[model samples]
Each structure stands twice: as structure tokens, then as C-alpha cells.
Target: MHASATRLPSAAAWTVGDITVRRIDEIALPPQTGPWLLPGATPEVVSQLPWLKPDFADETNVLRLASHSFALTVDGMRVLIDTGIGNAKTRANPAWHDLDTDYLTRLAAIGFTPESVDLVLLTHLHTDHVGWNTRAEGGSWVPTFPNARYLTTRTEWDFWSTTELDEPRTQMFRDSIHPIRDAGLLDVVDVSAEGTTVAPGLTLLPTPGHTPGQVAVRIDSRGATALVTGDCVHHPVQLADDALGSCVDIDPEQATATRRALLASLAGTDTLVLGSHFPAPTAGHVVTDGDAYRFLPYGM
Candidate 1:
């Protein structure tokens, strides 16, 4: 289907201290050049980074990217970090095959439904980050948050549940991750453990090589902080070309050394980075732009 155009400002909540974070857009892809999705992203290296024009490229430079998700309320909890590219799955990339949009009606118009989500943070298991975690009902494939709790990372569920994928990532692990492990709610955790907590301000860092065991969702609260970069900085010109990766970064030199140590631990720090395929003001802050690094997005 995919017809709703002109809905630019999709959603973008952001609180931080009390912890809110919202960003629900499911598609905002226009300018796409750079050898077609970041192979050094040329246009003369993004026109020598003119602070990435307009809102991340397009004055002919072309780059824009977005496929969103990140609800994240705090104490009472309602997580949901990455679950885009979902709807009618059968993808071999024909721009994410067999699709439709209105991602859960834009996640219940931002109030978040799907049984009020309790937690579904899968920062890995790519294929557009586990396409909605399941939802094709009558024809089968279920668990679209039926009382959440989906988290991942037992080394990213033992490498996509015993690696061997091909036909569109083994039909995206048999329909969005084995129907959330057949509805037992799938919770693998142990993100290289040390009090991994996924609530009370949420946490889990291990920014692995874009896929390996990829995790990133920090959030903190009253003291304020935020991370959520699940694809490890997809576009923001890879925060000033840290060897520009993402041609499906399987290990582009350990995803460019995990994006230069998470942009040197949030360059100047006020944290708040939220970019899993960043597009419209997709939240940002990592600075220090001399040797390289600069994604100041939040509201500018």
C-alpha cells in the first residue's frame, strides 16, 4: 500500500530527565545517492560536510534515511526500540518487499498500544530490526506485542538463531523471529552482563559491529542521557565519515571500530542520540568535529 505522503513531522517526543523518547516514523526516505546507501557516500564526500544541508543531505547531495521506532516511557515502562520494515514481509529488498504502512497505525498515534507494550528492545537481529516482531495474523505469524517482553542479545540470540540465512534472512527468522519464540515472549538478555537493567531509566550498551551482538539503548533519567543508536549511526554522514561503512555492515572493520567508540562516548555529552536510520530531527548531539564527528540534530 504505502500511500500516505506529506505527513512529514511523523512523531518526535523526547523528554530525557523524566525519560520519554518517542520518534515513531516508519518511512522518510527520499534522497539516496552515495553509490546507493553509503559506499563512502560521495557527492564529493557529502559536499565536504556542509553541516549536511537541510536536514541531512539533499541539495543534490542526496542521503536521507529513516525507518523508525523508539517509544520508551520510563518507570511504568513501555519500551520498543527497533521494529520497522514490517507489514507484509517477503523482502529481498525490493525496498523491503511486500509492504504496507501505517505501522500499527503509527503505534496507536503515539499513545502506544499493541497491548500497551511492556518492553520489546531488539537492537539487533536485523532485517530492518525484526520487522514489527510479528503480525500477519489469520495467515499466521503472530506476537505483535501481545503483552510484550521481547528483548534480545544472547549474542543476538545465538547469531540469528543458529546462523544460515539466505532467502530474505530465512524469511526473517521464520516470520519476525519465530513469532516471539512462539509467544513465550522471547527474552534472551545477558548483554555481556553487569546489571543489564532494561527499565528504571533503561540500559544495555555493547555496541557490537552493527550486527554481532549489537545493543545500544541507554536512557538514564533525572540526570538526563540518551543513546538508542541501534544501527550504530546509520546516516549523519556516519557522523563525519568514520571510514563510512553501512553497505550492510557485517563487520566493516568492526563497524568502523564501533563508530569510533560510540563517537568517543558522545563527544561533548548531553547524550541524547536516538538515530536508528536518522532522518527528521531524529534526536542528536555527539559533537567534536575536527578529527571527525558532528551530528547536532536535536532541534537544529
Candidate 2:
């Protein structure tokens, strides 16, 4: 862990009736992350959307992106959505490799310790998202959340497990993912087009395209609803234009479709939109911006 890591995030949050969703602090991804992840969101494109400046992007038009997770408690069940890039692991991406952030310390500070987590909802099995699934222990990787059931879509599990992985992905699985499965902690759920309810107020909405089985987490409690945009929507720039997609997307066309539909559902609704990769002021409401949409963050 870094010695100077902040004790807490800015503490961004939204309430879904009874559950208080907290944005657990993780490393603020470097500026280079924006270009590589969302190649279509050029400086020209982001400049046109004045709303994105300062918070979502820098003056130079570099989009701001972060790696964080949402945590909450309901009915005595603790739920953590998406684990960020972990520490001391071999990663192909230089920004992610050997990241030694105090992510777990921040999580534990919020009362969601490795042992306290009941459900670890993985949006997808990407390297950054699943890094925390395991930790270097006795020269071998082990499940970080030993007590929690690591839940993911059956489609996602099957695709990765069966497909021939490249060296990087193979290394990722060997270190961060396989340990969970070996520990009998990995559980897959079949999500239909309509979506699947995972817990009392939590539902996994199928938003494929970024990956074969990527699902966005929807939390509804006491009539209030909030949606967590997993990989389906990487950054707020995608909100300005549906065409702006991540270069790593498995299917660009389908990813665009999923993003469009998901944004439409959220447009002008009370449902709080929590972006998995969004920078501070991460949770917000979606608003239409003439032929497109803009993220009206919570504070403003």
C-alpha cells in the first residue's frame, strides 16, 4: 500500500431508499488511460461539450477516468460492485501493473472489509475490474474476499473460460481470477434480456457489447432506483456521443447499442447513474442535451 494514500475518497454517494451507495476510493487512472480506453473521444470531440470540462476532462481535453467500486449494505447484506486494479500483480498495461493503492484500506474504512463483504458483484472479468479478486499470498494468489460469493454472468464466465486467451489475459486469470474459482467462491448467474434480480433490491441488467456478458447493476429500494454503468459506458464522453466507444470493446456496434438504450432509460429520470469508471462526483442523473445527453453530477 502507498504510504501517502488518502484515508478516504471524496465520499461520493447516493441513496436508494434504504441503501447508501458509497464510491470506494481507488487510484485516479492516469490521463493516458482516457486516450487508450476511449479512442473516439478526441480532444476535438470533448471540446464541443463544454459541460465535460474541468471535472470530466482537463483543459487540454484529456478525459478524466477513475477506477473505483460501489459499496452498500441492505437487509444485513454487504454488497461491493466491481473490484479495482490490485497491487503487486503483473499487468500488461503500465498504468495498472503493480498498482499498490490502499483500496482495501479504504474499503475497510467504509465498514466493508474483505471478510465482511457478502457479495462481490463483478461487472466483467477485465484485468482492472477483477484485480482485487485475489492477492499475492505466500507466493500464490488467493481470493481477497474469502467470505463473499463472487457473482458474475454465466455468459461472461463461459466465454473467457472456453476461449483461448492471449498471454496477458491468461496471466490475469492465473493470478487474479482462477483462485476464486478454485476456492469454490465463483458463482455464475444467467441474465436474460429483461435482467436478473440478484438480491432483495439489487438487479443485474444485461448490457452486453463491451463483453459478451457484461451487466449493469441496478439498485431499487423503497421506490428509489440507481444504475451502475459497468463497462457498458466507460466515461461521460460516451454520454455526449454514442459513437464514442472504448477501443477494447469486443463488439463496437453492439456496445454502442447497449450504451444508447441504457442512456435512454436513464434520461430525465430520478434514477441515480453511477459510472464505474467516472472520476469524482461519480454518481449523478442523466439529462438530455440536444441530440445527446450530459451527466448532471450530484453536487451540481
The candidate scoring highest on lDDT is: 2
lDDT of each: 0.79, 0.88
lDDT of 2 by residue, 132-179 (tens): 999888989999999999999999999998999999999999998889
Q: Relative to the unseen true structure, what is the Cα RMSD of model 2?
A: 4.5
Clashing pairs in 2: none
Q: What is the per-residue lDDT of model 1 for residues 163-210, given as tens digits with 9 covering 90 to 100?
A: 777887887888998878887998898865343776787888887776
Specify the poorest-scoring 10-residue window by lDDT in model 1: 1-10
Error in Å for residue 33 of model 2: 1.0
Q: How many collisions per candidate?
A: 0, 0
Look at candidate 1 and tell me the lDDT of residue 211.
82
TM-score of each: 0.34, 0.96
